[model samples]
Target: MANPDECDTMIVGLGAMGSAALHHLASRGVKVLGVDRFVTPHIHGSTHGRTRIIREAYYEHPCYVPIVQRAYELWAALEKEIGERLFVQTGGLMIGPPEGELFAGALRSATEHGLAHTILEPAEVQARFPGFRVPRGSLALHEPRAGLLLPERCVEAHLALARRAGATIRTGITVTGWTADDGVRIATDAGELRARTLILAAGPWLPALVPDLDLPLNVERQLFHWFEPASHPEWYDAAHSPISLIEYADARFFATFPDVGHGVKAGIHHEGAVIDIDAPRAPASAAEGVEMQALLARYLPQAAGRIVDRATCVYTNTPDHDFLLDRHPAHPNVIIASPCSGHGFKFASAIGEILADLATTGETSFDLGPFAISRFQAPAT
Candidate 1:
C-alpha cells in the first residue's frame, strides 16, 4: 500500500523524439520524468546512425515543409545553446525521372512553398557532380537547404540540456504497462509511478505498449554501410559532394551522404525485411553488401570501394509512410508518438516541441491532420 511516484508528465522512450520532448518540457519548468530501456544515445533505435538527411523540400508532401522549417530553426538554436555541432549543410539532390515520385514530389513542394531549388538535366548533374552518373532521361532537383543532421550528438545535447533544466531521466528501466483513469499509472519493472499526463514515444516498441489499438505498424530491419572511395576520392568529400537520393528504378530508392570522417554512408530506403522488435537483429549480409556495391557501381561508381563498416537499425513504419503523432483514441491523457516510417529523424526537433505543446495545452499550432491516429480508426456503420 505504498504511494506511487508522481510527476506532472511522464515520457517513455528517450531517443530522438523523447529526448527532445524532455528538453522542451523541462525548460518550461514542468516536473517531467523520462525513462528509457537503454542509454539515451544507444544504437538500438531508429535515431542512432551518425548522419540523417534534413531537407527543406519534402518529397513526401508539402505539409512537411513548415514543420521541417521550424526544425531547422530549433536545430540551429540547440547547437548555439549547447555549443555542439549537430547539422552540416552539404546541399542535396533528388535524382530521378521528371515524373518519378522523388523528383515530382520534391518539385511540387518546392514550387508550392517557393523554396530555392533548381532542376538539373542529366549532363548538368553529371558535370556538376562527377560522383553521380545520372541516366540520360533522369533529372535532379537540387535544394540548397538539404543536408545531414548528426542524430547521436543531437540526442546527447537534448538529454544534457534536459538534465540541466531539472528533468529526471532514468535509463535501463522498462515500462511494463500503463493504466489511464483520472491520470496515468505506469507499471515498470522497478515499481509503479503516476503522472498527470503520459507521452509514449517508444519508437519500435509502441505496438507492445498499446496492443488493443492493433495499429498497422510494421518494423523493418535496415542496413547502413560506409565504404572507402576507390577512385575520385575528392568527389566524395562533404564539400564537393551533396547528399543525394536516387530513384534508380521506379520506386526503388537509395540515399548517400558525403564522407564526414566516416566513409561515404549509403542505404537503400524502405528496402528492408519486416522484423520483430525483440528478435535478434542481423548484420548486413554479404549479399546485401554486394547489392549495395552494385548500386554504387551503377550510379556512384567512385564510391564502390572496400566496405569499411556496416550497421543495423530498425524503422517503425506506418502504412502510409507518414508519422503517427496523436492521442490514444481510448485515453485522452495518453499520447502516442512513434511509427516514423524511415524518414522521421529530420523532424524530431519540431516534433518534440509539438509533443510538448500537445501534452501541455492539448493542441499544437502545426497542422497535424495527416498524423492523427484516428486515420486508422474504422468507419462506423
Candidate 2:
C-alpha cells in the first residue's frame, strides 16, 4: 500500500449516502476518493431494497419535511440526468386505527407542513384501494407526493454520475481502519489513503470505525418479500395502487411498488431482529413470512402468497430512531452519517447535499437538530 499524500475528502461508504456525497463533492471539483467493500447496487448494505417509501407528509416527524422535499426535487433531477426511470408517483397512504401513530402522525405532519392529504374512512379507503382492506374502525391519510424509490437504480445512477463528475471511486476495496494523524489516514485493502477530511458514512460498519464514539448503532436485519397478488393485480399497480403504511392491532409497517416486474414488494420496518454486521445475516425465514402473512391476512389478504423471493439487508439505527449526522467530537474533520432507522432511503439525495455542505462549508441550511449526535449521547449505546 502506498500513500498519494493527500485528497480533499475520503468517503468510507459507496452506498446511497456516500455515493450521493461523492457526486455532490466531485461535481464541485473537489478531489474526493470513495471506497466501498463491494460494488454498489449489491445486497450487502441497506440501500439494495427493491422499493423504498418516499412520502412528503412524513409520519416519522415534521422536522424531516424540508430535507425530504429537497430529496424529491433531486430524485426527479437525477431521473432526467440519468435518463432512466428512478421513481414512480403512486401517492401514499397511512392506514391504521384512527388514533394510531400512522394516521395521527401523518395528520400531524400534514397539518404542520400544510401538506395536501385526505382523511378517509375504512369504507372510503377500500373503495379507492380495493387491494387494501383496513380494519373496520380504521382511517387512512393519503398524501399525493409520496410514492416509491427504485433503490438499486438510484444507487447506480448516483455512482455513475459521481464517477463521471471525476471522483475517484474505488470499489472492492474495504477500509481496514482510519485515524487522525495530521489530517486523516485511511488504511484500505488495496492502499493507504490520505485526505484532508474524512466522512464515515459506513452505515452498519460505522460504530466499528469509531468505537470511541460509542454509537448505539444496531444493525437490524430487515427482510423484503415479493409476493404474488391473489387478485386485483392491476389495482395494486403503481398507477392505481398507492404506497401504503398500515398500523393495525397486529403490527405496523409500510408497503408498496405497483408490480414493478417482480411483484408488490413489502416489509415491516421496525420488526427486524438486532444483528451484528460481522455475523451472517439471517436468511428470510418462514417465521418471518408468517408475521407478514398475519398482517396481510388481517388487512390485505390478497397480497399474501408463497413468497417468490426474499433478501436480507441491514439498517444502522440510533436509540432515538433518528440519524446521527455529526462531526466527530474530538476530530471535527471527521463526520458521521447513519440517517436510517429502518426508514431513511427517501432522503438520500438531501442527505448527500447536507454532507457536501458540511464537508465544504461546515454548515447546512436544513435543521439537523433532530439528527445530531447529542440526541443519542445518553442512550446511544
Off by over 4 Å in 2: 1-5, 378-381
What lDDT does candidate 1 reach at residue 104? Answer: 97
lDDT of all predictions, in order shown? Answer: 0.92, 0.83
| Residue pairs whose backbone atoms clash in candidate 2 | 238-258
Tens-place lDDT per residue, model 1, 1-381, is 122267888999999999999999999988899999999798888988799999988999999999999999999999999998999999999999999999999999999999999899988988999998888899999999999999999999999999999889989899989999989999999999899999999999999999889999999999999999999889998888999999999988999999998899999999899999898898899999989988978888999899999899999999999899998988988999983899999999899999899889999999999998889889778
TM, every model: 0.98, 0.95
**Overall local distance difference test of candidate 2:** 0.83
| Total clashing pairs in model 1 | 0
The candidate 1 region of ten consecutive residues with least summed lDDT is 1-10
Candidate 2 structure quality by residue, lDDT tens digits, 144-223: 98888998889888889988988887789888888895599888878788898899988888888988878777888887
Per-model C-alpha RMSD: 1.8, 2.4
Question: Candidate 1: which stretches are off by over 4 Å?
Answer: 1-4
